[model samples]
Target chain A: MNWLGLVPFAIFSLLFLLLPTFNIVLGAFRTQQGAATLDNVMNLAQPRIAIAFWVSIKLSFASALIGCLLGFILATTVALGGLPRWLRQSTLTFSGVASNFAGVPLSFAFIATLGRVGILTIVIREVFGINLYGLGFNLLSFWGLVLVYLYFQIPLMILIITPALDGLRREWREAAEILGATGFQYWRRVALPILWPPTLGTMALLFANSFGAIATAVALTGSQLSIAPIVLFNQIRGDVLQDPQLGYAIAFGMIVITGITNLIYIVMRVRSERWLK
Target chain B: MKSARLWSYLIFLTGVMYFIIPLIGMFEFSLRKRRGEYSFDAYTSVLTDAQFQQTFLYSLLMALVAIVFGILLVVPTAYWVRLRLPKMRPVVEFVTLLPLVIPPVVIAFGYIRLFNTSSVLPFLGSQFGTDVLLSCGYVVLALPYMYRAVDTGLRAIDILTLTEAAQGLGANWPAIIFRVIFPNVLVAVLSGAFLTFAIVIGEYVISALLDRPAFGPYLVWIGSNKAYEPSALAVMTFAVTWGCMALIQVVTRFSKHTRTSI
Candidate 1:
């Protein structure tokens, strides 16, 4: 009787989440004629598809690594480094907004701030005589996308890791100090170990987050750039391959990568939670 | 401690600048419509445009539908799981998080394939049906935040005891849920609703693929085609997002105040 309450949610998830994903996975293993084959997966080995995957991996890796590092420093400053209390609250509140604030408006904001005739571009040129475009800084380039991705990625990391940092009790530090451990030694030996799981997990989460993002890249660079999600977007919109099964294969590949990364993140979160207990 | 505090101030200021500068630039650019001087011409132009009003209203209505459906679905399930099925938490959580991992384009693709004109359900059979599908997509996308907020709220209160007390008073399940459980978690539901509102308002991919006139795709349309108007739209979008976040803060603080006074 109690189990009946979950029926609606179960039906919703099965219809929307599980079945659609299963359809893609199943379609990836079939040809257009409905015959089972491995050609769809093999098509992923082509140079164009492989290069798309490579570019995506490089972007996700660079953004996640840099975002993790910078976010950790910022989170530490707010949660432990002892700024004003209101600063922490305001930062967190803003992080919540900035992290969710992606897609078209986000890209528009970046362009208004950094485009060739942008406000900052004009200011820097007039005041310091520095031409950002002359420095090869295109807002539509690969590195430019990373910079835009970081706008949200850093705050996401701060939001996720702040609580873990707060979990670092004062007693642990004092205990290590009493045991003749120096500050550096204490952090290296004690704090680092406890934080490893969450830090690594957050990086993995960020990797998956960036891997699946499409709108920001689309809005900023248009269809000219060849990121994984953009490739998938074009394929979905137009079936550019002329082979629907091949399109499913590309999406399946995306899911596989993000799924693995998310799995790692979940495992690490469980490990860290056990340590907390 | 003094040196550490100084370092904190330095790092915090740097982060604040990184976040604040783009917003300031967007606002300044939005005002630069009159050439060599700042004015509100861009804002006036955007606010006066008929398409802007149309798309903005469309997205606002869609956001409301998503919030209502999200609350109706999430609150009861969260309450029931807390009240009865503790073992189902992990399964429910994983399902909710699935939307985050799946890109919006992928989901929209799935919707196209799964509910096209020739499909069994045929959600895209007509414009109204397609709008329903778009709102459903928003609910799916916002599921993670909505479920987590409601679940966290449920956890804060004594669910089993409250339910039993309501039951002992001869109340039916619906009354117990609506009258008793709903009020207790109203704050959490409102937080989730505001977040959902923020997310659904500026969403582009799903609506664009579905060929809906959402504010998100309209923003993109202007962004590629217009000059200063895109900056004006950016400022407007940022203001809407900021307003939602402020409302969340106000709701949370109000809840705390009421809880303490009681």
Candidate 2:
């Protein structure tokens, strides 16, 4: 076999994926004149940059956790809750569409649903005399963004974790029940252990998915929201703070975080397959 | 047992509401263009606008290019890896997944710097060149989906034996791959292509930063200025996405039926 058959793929990845990322990393540690320096990375310690990172982490963590939990419930309901075959198929198909129904149009959909003059907002006010804005639920805040992010995040969780749920053998459940264990006990003892790896892996995927998202947040919250991706977006586009090199540092940081998350996801996936072996 | 059913029903109902409400709201808001009544004025306006047609057509052309280029790059590589370089499967899969981890903004950022007019490879030297670079970036963004779909398709068929059989019959490598293998996995390639279309159609970050007149940036522009028209555009975008996904379902179903009947 000519192993050289793999050359084109390698070169494409190098030119597109690895090289651009390497440029960011290399640029992160150098001055404009090419001298090696730590100033760009150090700029991350500035309160604003540090807060941007914190806010991003907090948003990703909240959204991923909520998405994972809700998606787990939805998937378990469809896959294991004795739903009909058509329901399962329809759910899967809808999840496929909704998960990809993200970015710019998703923001518009949410705005029409929950914005100040939204249908739900108007209905609540007319029916119960309660203002949604007065309830501190602005769709542009951190909580609001989490609410929007869950629209896709939960569907994504459902799409990924459904198979894992299916991988759960009925024999295990029957065996647990024959041993006089309740349904809850079967899940806690037999099911949760087997599912831990995939569950965690899916959560990490969700985290990275939301962390690197730029368009929906930018469209909904504008560039005013100090999330990491938006901050990075402005920096890359305008060098808004007058330091082009610091932009490289921020992009480098995003790569490191996402890479680490994905690495954990890969490790968990490998570990999850151990049971099958 | 009944309680479990009830719980399941409640959860499913809640999920359906969550998924459907935004779409309903967008549709309803779009119809509110006539003030205190319902009409399709907003849709008509968005459809008739010259800029909308231009940008939508521009993005559609870009989507086609990305899908074609993505297939050209992915199919052969996936086929070769499965047929010859089995040891390189892990490496190839890892490379495919790299695009998911890296944000589009970062990729476009790198392109602006690395392919600017002054750079050795000047992809941004002209407007046409910038469109090519933007489409290339779309290919990267859609790589994860395209590669995975094509790879899964390849795995479904028996490529190794087919290649050997064709080789023994005095067929050359290109003939074996194109004539024999390509037609077999055409369904899988079509599924991936539709998905890439969905992704490239409404993408905002890369095209916005690249200053392309694409549908995504146009949607954002309308959102900032117009009220009801943005909702109309949102509904239209949703319909397009649904169409792509439904086409995927049909293709898969058709492929399965054909396989079973044979």
Candidate 3:
């Protein structure tokens, strides 16, 4: 009976999650001769791969940092005293729905609203002769990916951090105040120390989430972009790479990055749990 | 102080505006006719077309199938973990979070590699084989939220007491499990199901990978090639996601138990 309960989850996980991952890892080393080698893993050091790798890391860090700062402030404000409980809950519900609200349609939305031919683009031109593109900020390039990623990242930040903030005891803040700690002094010495761990973990999770995403990036920037997931997507879809095994190799690269990020999440979660204690 | 408050309000309101403008823009674009006046022509086209109707029906049915799969896979483990396997709760929780940590794109590829070969897996050969595999994959993608909802409901209940009472009545395994346990977790399952419905209805990654013409893939193709109709399709998807969320709100409004997770 116990095995029955475990059986369904195990089978689904194996068929859907584990096997694909297994296929990706094993496919990485198999040569064209059907023999395994180090060629695929070693491909990470190629010049173009190096550029894509650097760009992805930079964009992810910048977006995650901006998202975390904005999310932390937003969470602290409502979770403390900025909004009434009803308002706070309502805002959160909206944010929750919107945060999970990305993918193909989201890319379409951004394009139609902010793209070169977008409505706001025409309006901004007439109003200020400030062509959005003239300003050299292409919403269809590297910055565009960041913009779309931020669409969800900030809300995710708010969602994950708000509940943790709800656990912050007001009495502690009051005690710090009574001890003659000024506002800045109190936050720096008290709140920052208490809040750093969860804030950091949420930041890491958001980075990983954005890092492994493909649809939004692909739809917005075109699949030819060198992002690892986009490359893998193209591979599997019969694009540049003809072999599905090569696609699996690309997928393996993505999994390694995500796996590393998730391991970081685990470590952060444990440290956050202890720090909260 | 007042000016600072105004500044903060401005920032937050700007964020809200940016978020909503695209949804409104899609609908606005969908409504405008060739005469440059608002009309229902786009929607009428979408509605009257046999392919559109078929795709929408397929999507709705697929959503339900995935939701049912979610309940079947997640409900059992969530119950047993909360009741008999208390020690394994953390491990169970960790497994549920796996889909989120590994992005959807990677997982979608994983499915193709694992199940694409007919010779390897006996079931990947036919249409039925692929669709069933797709639903199973959808369940995995939606697992974190669905399982969490059920687990939260379990935390709110005295599951041990419920199971023990059923056992004392000499109810067998299935009877005690279904009759006593499932009743309390029904709302959690419903909430999870609705979420799964939204995800599967709009999901493009897995469906496209599997080469199925599901709703998400339909929307993607329409959006990319045909500009005007894509806006109409976006409006429809927007309505569907919003409707699902609103439906859940209405259901929770009437019920005594409301579980909120962000």
Candidate 4:
């Protein structure tokens, strides 16, 4: 009788979420006539598809690494760096907002700030007499997207890692001090050991977060960049490659990558929670 | 300690600058619609645009539908899982978190492939059907946050006790869920709803692929077509997101205050 309560929810999930995903995963392996084959999956080795996957991975890695470093620094400064209470409070509130402020508007904001004829670009050219374009900085390039991604990625990192930082326990630091440990020695021996798990976990989450991003990339770079999401977007819109199964393969590959990263994140989070507890 | 504090402040200032410069630049750029003078021309244009109005309203309606449907689906399930199916907690959690692992583009692709006009369930056969599919996609995208919020709220209140008391009073399941459990977790539900609104309003991949007139696709369309107006729209979008987060804070604080007063 009680099991009947989950019926509607179960039906909704099965229909909308599970079945669609299962269809995609199933399509990735099947041929046009529905015969199971490895041809589509093997087609992922083509230069176009492979390059898209590689670029996507590199972008995700760069943004996640940089976001983690910067976010950890900012979070540490606020949580343990003797900042005023109000600053910390406001920083957190701002982070909660900024982390969710991704997709198209974020790309728009970045373009207005860094695009050609953008205010900062004009300012730099007028004041410093140096053209950012001449300096080989294009907002549509790889590094440009990383910079834009960092806007939200860093805030997300700060939000996720703050509690773990708070769990660093003042007693442990004081105890290390009383044991004649230097600051560097304390961090190396005590703090870093404890913090590394959550930091790395957050990096994994950040990687997956940016890995799956499409709107910001599409809005900012158009179809100029061959990142996996954009490629998939184009494929879905018009079948640019004229092969729907290869598109499924690409989407399958994305699911696999993000799935692995998120799995790592969950594992690392569990390990860190044990220690934090 | 002195040097450490100074270093912290330096890093903090740098972070602040990195975050603030784009916003300042955007605002400044948005005012550049008129040569040699700052004006709100760009904002006015964006605000008055017909496509913007239509797409914004369409996304807003979709967001509302997603929130209501999400609450209906999630609240009862979360309540029941807590009260009756505690052993299935991990499975429920993993299923909820699947959206985070699977990208929105992939999910949207799956929907296209599975529910196209030729498929058994032709959700994309019409605009209304596609809108339903898009709303369900938003709910899936937001499942992680919504489920976590409701679950955290359930943990705060004693569901077992509430359910037992409601049962002793001869109330049915729907009444207990709606009357007893729902009120207790209203704050959590509202927080989740605001987050959902934030996500659905600016969503791009699902709605874009589905060919829906959503604000996200509209933003992207304008971004490519217009110059300064994109910045003004960006500012507006940022405010909407900020408003959502702010409301979540306000409600959570309000809930705490009422609890303390009680």
Q: Which parts of model 2 have CA positions greater than 4 angstroms off?
A: B257-262
Interface RMSD of 2: 1.1
Which candidate would rank higher by TM-score, 1 or 4?
4
lDDT digits (tens) for residues A1-277 of candidate 3:
5556677777777777777777667878888677978877777666765576667777777788888998787766666645557868777877767776777777877777777766677778989788888889788788777877787888899988876777677888899999999879988998888778778878888878888776677667656678766666676778674655556566677677767777877787777776565
- Which residue segments of model 4 deviate by more than 4 Å? B258-262
Per residue, candidate 4 scores C-alpha lDDT tens digits across B154-255 of 988888999999999999988999999999899999999999999999999999899998999888888889988999999999999999999999898898
Best TM-score goes to which candidate?
4
Instruction: Judge candidate 2 at residue A220 and give its lDDT.
Output: 89
Candidate 1 positional error at B108, Å: 1.0
- DockQ winner between 1 and 3, please give it: 1
lDDT of 1 by residue, B31-66 (tens): 988988989999999999999999999999999999
> lDDT tens digits, residues B90-164, model 3?
877888888887767777776765665654784457888888887877888889889998888777778788788
Better of 1 and 3 by TM-score: 1
Quote model 4's TM-score for chain B. Answer: 0.97
Give fnat of each prediction, in order. 0.68, 0.68, 0.45, 0.86
lDDT of 2 at A24: 84
Most DockQ-accurate candidate = 4
Clashing residue pairs in candidate 1 are none
Judged by lDDT relative to the true structure, which candidate is superior, 3 or 4? Answer: 4
User: What's the C-alpha lDDT at position A270 in model 1?
Assistant: 95
**Order of all candidates by lDDT, from best down to worst?**
4, 2, 1, 3
